[model samples]
Target: MHVVVNAATSADGKLSSRRREQIAISGEKDFARVDRLRADSDAVVVGVGTVLADDPSLTVKDEQLCERRREQGDPEQPARIVVDSTGRTPTDAAIVDDAASTYVCLSEAAPVDRRMDLADRAELVTAGEDRVDLLRAFAALEAAGLERIMVEGGGELIFSLFEAGLVDELRVFVGPTVIGGRDAPTLADGDGFVAEFPTLTLESLERVDDGALLIWRADG
Candidate 1:
């Protein structure tokens, strides 16, 4: 599967404030760009932390884009996938809505009741014992015919993807604003790399609104 990780960060490389709240870092042009990205993907993935913090619908927003997908005999919106180890995704989360197919990747350790609750709203794919095994989950996703995946992330998930060498591309929109806080989330945050950092080759750069878009391909 082709996996792309996309995100918007402030000038200081912060995804959001320490409060973990959603903040608008990109402008209308960038938003439209992201909509196009979503429309082109087979599935859009995110971690549970993002779902809880942003509650994004993860649907294609442009009607023209939806029409184009329909013309190509594709769904109006791409499928949505969430990495929730313990099944903490709220049943009524926007991702679980009928706008698109939703998949919750859970771990075997997730409670049966919680898994049952999510099963009613979304497809459940259980993998790891304590955490959602990304490789296994992605294998299942690929088997289900999702070849192109776009990951709009929370830092933890992004870090994990890179750590597992699953990411194919990294795209970041650096906005003009500055959000400075030590506890703020960065583009990739988990236990950060100490050695043997992931190498990325610059793919492209463009100006979007008041910010810059930098895309890098993962170097093997």
Candidate 2:
């Protein structure tokens, strides 16, 4: 399976949406890149916090991105996946009601009753501890035939996924503007492991419009 991470950050390396709102420093080109990635992916996933905050459709809104997807096979919109460890995504949320399909990855500890209630509109899968199991979640998606995944992250989710060593490619567009806040979010938080080192290798770097793009791969 191929996993791609798409992130937009400010010059100061803050990933948080300014004032807790979308469309912060990141510009059109960067958003288009995200749309294109989603157009080319089999699934797009984000954390529950993002779902609650952004309320995004997660569909390819760019016309070019849509056309490419059609030429490639008229692919159905990428499945919207949410990691709602506590089953907190409201039943009426657009993530469940708007997409052709929405998959909620919750913890095994989450009650099955909550899942059953939403079965008609959303597919719920159990995955991590009191949280969605990142590894098993990917395994389930792979088994279900989603070969490529693009992760649109919120802080904790990115941290957890990277900590689990699950991402195959990382893409970030650093916008020229800076939004500085002492506790603003970052693309990835430190993993809890008391480790000597992590073996990471940079794959490529380039400038996309006014933003910078970075790509990386896991060690092995």
Candidate 3:
């Protein structure tokens, strides 16, 4: 299974401003690019923090992409997967509004009631004890026939995935603007790596509307 990380950040490396809410770092062209990526993947992954902050629909919005997927015998939209360690994703979030199949990945620490509450609306998978073990999450996702996964993240999820060494490809959009607050979220947010930091080989770079798109493959 291939795990791809996709993120758009300011030139200063912040995903959002000091407000820590959903910020538009990508332009319409970037959004269309993301929709194409979503159409190419079997599942789209994100963390609960993204749900709380952005309330994204996580669906492929381009009509042509939808048609292309359908022609290829794929679902019109990729399955929406949320890494909610404690199962706090709201039932009313846009991801759970019946527009697509949704899965809530939880930790064993999540309350039974929370599990039950989400059972009807979305499938639940427990991946770890105190937190969502991303490695196990990958196995479960692959087992469920979602072989290609695209992770659209908040910083914590990005750090967790990179820390686990699970990322195979990374696509980053560097917007021309800057959100430089010290507390602003970046591409990755977590404790520093205990040992060697992972590296990537630049695969491609292209100019987008008012920014640049960089794609990298994890260096072995």
The TM-scores, one per candidate, come to 0.99, 0.89, 0.97
- Candidate 2: pairs in clash: 127-133, 128-132, 128-133
Q: Of 1 and 2, which scores higher on lDDT?
A: 1
Encode model 1's per-residue lDDT on 44-70: one tens digit a residue: 999999999999999999999999999
lDDT of 2 at 158: 81
**lDDT per residue, candidate 2, 140-217, as tens digits?**
988988889999988788878878778778888888887777667777754544763445678888887887888877
Q: After superposition, how far is residue 143 of candidate 3 from its true place, in Å?
A: 0.4
Candidate 3 stretches greater than 4 Å from native: none
Query: What Cα-based lDDT does every candidate model obtain?
Result: 0.96, 0.79, 0.92
Model 1 lDDT, residue 145, Cα: 95
- Give me the overall lDDT of model 2: 0.79
The number of the candidate with the highest lDDT is 1
lDDT of 3 by residue, 142-206 (tens): 99999999999988998999898889999999999988998998899988586788899999999
Q: How far off is residue 96 in model 2, in Å? A: 1.6
> Which candidate wins on TM-score?
1
| Model 1 stretches with alpha carbons more than 4 Å out | none
